[model samples]
Target chain A: MPPRKPASKDPEPLPRSARKDLTRAKLLQAALTLMGEGRSFTSLGLREIAREAGLVPNAFYRHFRNTDELGLVLVEDVGITLRRLLREARKMDVAPRDMLRRSVSVYLEYVKLNRLQFLFISSERSGGSRILRLAIRNDVTHFTNEMAQDFRIRGLYAQLPTASLQMVCGMIVMTMLAAATDVLDLPPDQPLLEAEMSENFVQQLKIILFGATRLNDALTRS
Target chain B: MPPRKPASKDPEPLPRSARKDLTRAKLLQAALTLMGEGRSFTSLGLREIAREAGLVPNAFYRHFRNTDELGLVLVEDVGITLRRLLREARKMDVAPRDMLRRSVSVYLEYVKLNRLQFLFISSERSGGSRILRLAIRNDVTHFTNEMAQDFRIRGLYAQLPTASLQMVCGMIVMTMLAAATDVLDLPPDQPLLEAEMSENFVQQLKIILFGATRLNDALTRS
Candidate 1:
């Protein structure tokens, strides 16, 4: 008997594009898990990552050209994710003091939710990979620029020069990154230590914001 | 003729202890050079470091049990070097504004002189190795405590609470470290970029100090 052709009405259960996306995501997840385990990306092997994702070594090439390419993608993804979250946090209408506290709280909460991504960015910010380091720095520069714009819109530090505003924004980014590093480094068993770290981070931001306000006032008077 | 034993009046050309000390110093120097070249200590191999130092792999054991131990020694040496330089900077009797500028100048000079050591500390501060990260943090904490003590002696920040004093000192240290990282990461031929970073650092510190003085005044009035 002759074989009958399938009708066009029947749809494919899982399309090729979707399956490829799943595999790519799995590879990224594997990398994030390994980094979350305290291993830097430079120390990770392509084969190890592929194996963790349950694929053959050659399958990695289908997703990424190499580990550095994968790392760049990861850095970009984390940067976008963080900026989106922070932007959302800034949308809240609150007093300046409350806004500062709320922004920090939102940031810390994001770090908690995306522990591996935060850890990867913080660790690789000064890690061995120059490309990854540059990517993180670029993202940080973008973040600072956005922050400076926000400050300008709010008329905060309006009297300061553009360079000074960038400096203040840069300080805020660095301090937040440092706090995230400290939080991620804490052992999981030490809840008290984590709480203290969170509180201290808030207090540190308060001090910095206070100083920034005073500087703005002085510059205006001068 | 049989080799004659050294006479009581004859001194050894290179004493065993002195030779051992030189070998140890060579190892540390080799590691610093590697780190300055953008290779993190955690990514470095023991054999490679020994080879760079012109010593056999086994010879490394005499100086350190492992790379982590060598890293610990490096951290300690950098900490001591920085503390000594900062202490010298603090000894200058000048007005508070001039003092801030001078201290920053002195610190930047030290960074210029010891670029490798500073790079090592900054890179490893948030690097992969937990032990190295902890060692750097401990040194930073020690530096902050010493700064707080000096502040107490000079009646600086006298109106602030002890925790607030430490917070200010911690912010200063973190800011300096961030600036150091920027300077180290700059291209060697970019002197203009380096100068701008240095100028920006000084200005940033001035803003912080100005804010700190205001805080002190407000607390005093309250």
Candidate 2:
């Protein structure tokens, strides 16, 4: 075989814009990695994050004005990522029961695969950053609104008040988040333990769903 | 008016043990105050805490070996305070519906009254301290176990498996904690807003209880 032409030299060196984007992504991932080790974003230093990203401290400013700014961006990214996955799960053409099971499975898988992102989210949900906390709360409210709309579309609780629907959706979201935190907090080597937690989480979710449906029926009839 | 003997010159100085206890309480309260301001325990310095408590840095060692030790003590204290309040609420003689309404009200009121303690617990939950996180988790588990026993005694969900009961208890606890955090995170001047949030929280709890009861009946029938 020919020598492959030295992989085309620089392979058309990345454009300035793309290079900037790459650096920003690297910085965000580095922060995520540090946060995943249990340090809150407030405790994390800008220099440390820049070092972790293999960039100088000054380069950090090219992406974010400060750590809080970076944290806000991370919060937005996590919110978008989570909402997109859940929305896709809701879009699947499956039976209601299977949809729920699949949705939860996907969510847990995402939490496991994006350990750093989820860790950043869970920690910051009530961590030291006020802006991040509010950002998460807004995302939760937005997610709840989206879930309420999906339920309305499906006619799952057609007679229930909109507020009631929001309440139910909020509970489900909070439960799923709590479960994700619990699973991630477990020792990484404990696959068996993690599986058990996953099963328990599903059971808990089923119980809540069963209860919510029954309540909706009762309310409509009364 | 009598001079009252100038209030006695000695004034019966506090006993040594009482003085020690007061100092410990002061230190803990200082930590709580700092954590309440959106700072995680891991971000807190011993000297800062000591200063807040109006003591020298070296004096902090008299109460705790290090910040983690102080944090562990704080976790235990918070757990005890929470468990006691919940136990008292559970002991009230009222209908099931009233019981839940009253319990949540009491819980929220406690959160308001002990804002600092709740803030500490909320922050440390997923904070950087592994030991503190585990301590909180164990307290939660213990609290759930106690609730399960109480449910059994009350003839609630009598036919459900213990694990299922635990799941229910865990959900309730998580919901209450989330609610507490929400209330505390709100601006201090929002009385009207706080009341509205309280009402919404009550409604959400009612829905969960309604669903749990229906599930219990169904499980019994099946």
Candidate 3:
């Protein structure tokens, strides 16, 4: 099969297409929630997702070419969701520490809400349909590039090259990926709530940010 | 179907049992190699893994109840491997920084040699297998407890409790996992060659250690 195309835009949204898009969105949303509950996209069937969305199995094809294609959509959805959270969270005039605390909460909440999608994206690097994997890598690259721009704009990473910024972003994202999952048995649904898990996250962020900031400090000291 | 039990201990290591255990180990080893190639565990099948191990499909059942069960075993194996690496690495008579650098190199080399198992464990939790997910969590707890004991014996974590030490271990494992998996896409297997990745790892460790040390120092000064 030809590589599945991402949802295309039309100058004017057709009701039929809009409905299909809505159905697709709903399926993705349901999948994300299911993932949060610990379902894998590989094992998740299109029929089950459609059933969750209260649609017939045939209706799923109207949106996604197949389940693997839907997984790509889900991966893209996670990127969009996370970016949206970052954007909205950025609007708050809080200290970086406070913002990070809030961000952790928001991040966990996103995982809880879209568990399946978050897990799906998290696991994408491992065995998955080829198309889905590429989409995930694309999302990672896009997000990294986006963050470089954000950090540059804020002057936080003004001295760093895009590569270093990407490394920092990669580290942060990877740490968060570990945090977002229950692999650590953190003794809390959201580690941000547990004093221990939350403190660890705070310190982990501090260590990462400190390392980034200090790299600049070292360069200046030299 | 009932959950599969791992192999039993025997003095002589029965021919069939030993053979089953070796096949499982071989499959895991094969998975690790495949992981370096960027394949996730979910995308792989039993037949392929068994075939890779020069065994027939039915022979796989003698080892694992299913691929997910095999994934759980892989997680356990990774924890053991990592803990062994830390133990062996720490025994080297060198500067802490140099020791750490070499440790990372060893880690990368190990992953390069055992790609499938590492990738399987890394991808398991997010891949939505209950057994694998729980196994990863349990192994993490096991690792944290081990780290906490080591820290206590060395009196290294006086400033932090065992819980906090475990969290630190969790964060370090997260960073290591990220580094090992090529999640950063460091020029496609370039993390091993790039002095920067190991340098960053050491720097991050220093920041964690010294940052906490300095916090205590500052408190004393204040």
Candidate 4:
């Protein structure tokens, strides 16, 4: 058979740096796929991940020295994802007219949009992997701190002292994570269940905000 | 060597039903032990659990048809544990002074006493095994409902309607579960970190209670 001619529609090969980035992303996606399939983060093997990425075992080393490093990078990616979320939240109007419900809607949509990554973090955050658990915990604490900073910047809960505000933010963050478990586990196409869950989520956050507003006064009275 | 003889302090054998109960408990405990070791509930096997319990595989078959069945039983046990905790909380004085702190201290101590069980539930509640996840979720729902009932009986949050009261209890239960993750992971013998964590836990519960009290008014205005 004669040699096949190249298709004119084919684009030029990407540059070396860009191709490397593509391969790195492939490895990360492979890990997420495995985790999204319900495998614990601690149980993942490097060779298996490389195979899943359709690359040679040696290629895995080019992107990450080991699985733990890859795990850390995944967590770092989660940190960025959370920061981006906070940034989106900042863009929303701070006027408290049904703001909590709107934020919950946006956040739940985000959780569904990035379902696999959230699955990985939630499972590994408390799973058997000490390294992953601690890394995820660090990211959560950073997220909580940024939330407190956001509240300060927006002048919400202004009466709360810095420590008290931080504590309140921590509770809010915990509530968000807890709601995520339900959000991730929710069955598909069940609008009624989804509404009930969202309503519950909204009420929970409202309670926390109201609690923060009264805590300072209550402490003073005591 | 001379034939082995029963020790002088050895008591008579337990009845057959009691002996069966002992083996059943052992099998349940073996699952918790494996989960506490970082193995996902979905990854545990019947033979492996039986071996961990120092029992024959047949003994495991007598107790549970599969690992998932054993997992459901463990979830049921958690329900009983939660009920016992509520009973103890009920016994505490109904006065408002420092009650939240006292309840938190008792709950944290209870978590420490049942570290492996909490580890199993926390890890499996959102982990790979769908069956175990659902079962744990059910038990948690039961715990939340019972908490609401107790609140009604005790006249706490008396003005709130039943539906609102139940939602408040759900949020409280979620907070308790989140705190369990931290309490289970806490490093041993660190008084400072433990106190700090416990204080944060108290603040979170306080916020929830305060939020519950004012939620009705907030809703009416809206």
TM-score: the better of candidates 1 and 3: 1
**Looking at model 2 chain B, which ten-residue stretch has the lowest summed lDDT?**
B93-102
Q: What is the TM-score of chain A in candidate 2?
A: 0.89
DockQ score of each predicted structure, in the order shown: 0.56, 0.59, 0.33, 0.55
**What's the lDDT for residue A99 in model 2?**
66
Clashes (backbone N, CA, C under 3 Å), per candidate, total: 0, 1, 14, 0
lDDT of 4 by residue, B13-65 (tens): 68989989998998888888887776766667789999999998888889788
* Tens digits of per-residue lDDT for model 1, B117-201: 8888887888768898899899989998898888898899899888878888888889999888887777776878877888888
Model 1's i-RMS, to one decimal, reads 1.8
How close is every model to the real structure, measured as TM-score?
Answer: 0.91, 0.91, 0.76, 0.87
Per-residue alpha-carbon lDDT of model 2 for A146-180, expressed as tens digits? 88898898888787889888888888888888888
Q: Which residue pairs clash in candidate 2?
A: A211-B211
For candidate 1, write residues A176-204 as lDDT tens digits. 99999988888775878877777777767
Give candidate 2 misplaced runs (Cα > 4 Å). A1-12, B1-12
List the per-model TM-score of the A chain. 0.90, 0.89, 0.75, 0.90
How far is B164's C-alpha from truth in model 4 (Å)?
1.5
Error of 4 at A86 (Å): 1.1
Interface RMSD of each: 1.8, 1.9, 3.0, 2.1
List runs of model 4 lying over 4 Å from the truth: A1-12, A15-17, A37-48, A56-62, A218-222, B1-20, B34-48, B55-59, B217-222
